[model samples]
Target chain A: MNYTDVFGEPTRGKYVIAGINVGMILRKDWTTHQQARDYLCDFDGEPQIVEGIDDEFIREKHKEYPHLSLADCEYMWTGAHFCEELLKFDGFMLHASAVVYKERAYLFSAPSGTGKSTHTKQWLDAFGEDAYILNDDKPVIRLLNGKAVVFGTPWSGKTDQNRNAGVLLGGICFLERADENWIKPVGAKDAAFGILNQTIRPGDKKRLVKLLELLDNVIKTTGVFRMGCTISTDAAIMSYDAMKGETRA
Target chain B: MKVKSDFVLKEVAGQWIVAPSGDASISFNAMITLNDSGAFLWKTLEGGASEEELVSALLGEYEVSEETARAGVRNFVEKIREANLLDD
Candidate 1:
């Protein structure tokens, strides 16, 4: 399964993601991005598997989203592997729209087509200069010294919306569409179930252990909530107010 | 009865979460969270313990009486069995 033999010397690039230097080997058609390229250095990155990824694995992933190009599948495969590796550093990626307001990051996670983007857009419109999308999709969370921190990454879906930023995670809210806007606090146990749907689960038992441990810290250290919202600025403000721990007037 | 190999239990932040993994991961959406006593029964059942054996372990581990131990083991065993997480 040595990819170097199958495809000539893979494109090796070092990039800092989630504040960890990763020397990722991208094969044939997989691509890199400028966002991470800014953090390039000679510092040694962790060594990871470059050849064990199977064709059946890529095809199975592609079957879930057929619109993805071969290159997208290749890159997605690498991203999943990076996430698996990120587990060791107390980090893992969440499929969420992370927004930065007042310098703190708030992540909103949900299943696709669930208006995760539309709701976050309301935050942008509501707070023009004060709010920005840190990563529109797939932001990385790392528990640093018992504090949850969210970091922007290059593989931010098709929107390409991301910042080379790491902000203290303020809260993580699982979003849902509702006729009216409302928010409520969620316990850590319930947060685990909501989070499991949005994050990549590793294949083996050992890494799965790391993931659960990190997940425990992330949920415990940050505020977790569930919000039923509509695509309105008021809904955004309501969620923002609750997540930011601001008192309602 | 015994716990299936498809499921793995681990303690995270003093809580026990049981989730299906490997090939059985895709088809199920159920995840079981257990307390200290439930986790003990799960670890014991991993090697296949009888109902009486589970009750005895519960009695020995905690300072509970026989009736309470029997009820605790009964309730915990029924739950895993219902979740199909046990190989009975």
Candidate 2:
């Protein structure tokens, strides 16, 4: 019942994504101002949602309360938005979900309703616990020591699966709904565009270029792919193989 | 203006190339090289090379006489300065 205690459970995992130690706290509810404050302040996790009668509900609905700082509220929600790890791991967060297979992580990127969650679930069921979801909604990626590493985060769009960070990145897969499933290597320009499409940041041309630079480094190292698939693990498996190469360790 | 004496240069992240003690870091996509005269002028600017010293070094290293070196080095030093690749 203690949100803070759950979130601030000593961060026993190997890595901490965003601000929350995602390992201990799966999909759960936090329902009081004290609980919300404790949860937010404890691990410095952002307050993602104050809904479901948790804390700070001025009215009976999930709508924003006027007295509450909407700006701060939104900020709180995104506190643990992505992998903000490693000192200068300058990278952008995308509207994507990723899974870790072996030591390498594979990213399933898309805007909303583009089958990110559905594909992630397929990967999980297909690979079972062998594959782990980084963040189903807002996954973070950064370039560190000249490499792009993906981090597991706490923000899930009603997703139940939870864990700490993953290892290095496998590859980035930009999803497209297709009649049949197929995977293809993305060209450098297309790859850059794919990354850019999912990029989340406020900016002008200069900032966008900076983000592009970070993304360029990621594509240079991680490789990008375009995947067309039906709602089946077979497609997920194909996407995985394209990113991960052969099956099994 | 240029420095006087030995300066080393290095490039980082396809961005800038700079000397350890040099006052500037030059960013160019292509590799920048210095000719004998330019190298000599660059060398003379070791302890913060000056425009005159750069010319003198160019004269010493190239076939040009001191006067020509002075003018050429002066122009070249201006370019280097504009590129933000050298100390004043």
Candidate 3:
């Protein structure tokens, strides 16, 4: 039997991201009115402040939401709002889409519409069910003992797949699609820039320095790459193979 | 002096982020993180102050020459403006 039943409940699935323990609890009720009853979840003293939901409301809200929900949380929970709290609690949210391939997490991050979801789907189609998708939207990145670890939260893009969490960043991809498929390794400075851009934070001189420092530490331990590819499965496989080589390009 | 100015800012999500019209973005990646000096400069010039006002404030606060202060502030302001972080 699966140790975890559903998201948002006490189970083996509960784990810590950074120093913050993201505990989940799930509730299911058939009544449409019953769904409307809002529940409150707290992160330390800060409340999730979730409004009640009924089945229709949930379905409707789901349709209107910009992001996906693995469980039944609101899509408004962004990395910027939570990462600082998570960081203060010793955790941080990663600003990227994540998928688990061969039990390893691969992240695609860059500016919006840089094919993060498209790349994730490409990998999924290429690998079939052999690969699992964690988050196609906002995935959390936490540092464990100074090593970068990626977590799959319930939050995702339009895809409703609520896969469980995974640890260890197999590789990070900063996408820049071209006419041809190619995977290039990036150096610390470029990698730092790419990763820092994908991090959930504010922009200014001081923050830039801090982001630079954060990305520097993250890229030093976790390898970084620039994936220039097409929408082909071959390109997806090429990226996977490239990352497996484990050498900076 | 008719010195010109622009928006004030900080870094969020690894990009040069800023605040416009005195309101900041709600997302973490959208929030601008500023250092003490940058924050100070940002707030001072945030009221849409002119270049002269900005330079004068910097001169008074940081013990820097007018040319140096103007040049440095201009460069900083230029970077943020290029990123479109300014309000108006």
Task: Flag regions of model 3 displaced more than 4 Å.
Answer: A1-19, A22-73, A78-80, A202-213, A245-249, B1-88
Clashes by residue pair, model 1: none
Give the per-residue lDDT digits (tens) of candidate 3, residues A1-249. 122323223221233333354443223341211221221123463232222222344445567763655333333432234554554433455567787877678888867887888887888899998887777777767666676677665445555454546567788888877899988877654664455456554433344344444555566667678878898898889989888646222
lDDT of 2 by residue, A1-249 (tens): 233332222222222344323223322332212222222333444433222212332122226555544323433343433322222247567677877777787888887888988897898889887877776766667766776777654444455344456467788889989999998887655665565456543223344345556755676677678888899989878888788752121
Binned by DockQ into CAPRI classes (incorrect, acceptable, medium, high), candidate 3 is incorrect
Which one wins on TM-score? 1
lDDT against the true structure, per candidate, is 0.78, 0.55, 0.57
Q: Candidates ranked by TM-score, best first?
A: 1, 3, 2
Which digits, one per residue and each the tens of the lDDT, describe model 3 over residues B11-85? 433433343221232332333445555566777765667777777888888987789989977876775565455
Model 2 CA lDDT for position A135: 69
Q: Report the C-alpha lDDT of model 1 over A31-128, residue by residue, as the tens digit.
A: 44334455455665463323235455556777888998645776676677777778778889999999999878889999999999898899999999
**Candidates by lDDT, descending order:** 1, 3, 2
What is the lDDT, from 0 to 100, of the residue B29 in candidate 3? Answer: 35
The alpha-carbon lDDT assigned to residue B39 of candidate 2 equals 52
**Candidate that would win on lDDT:** 1
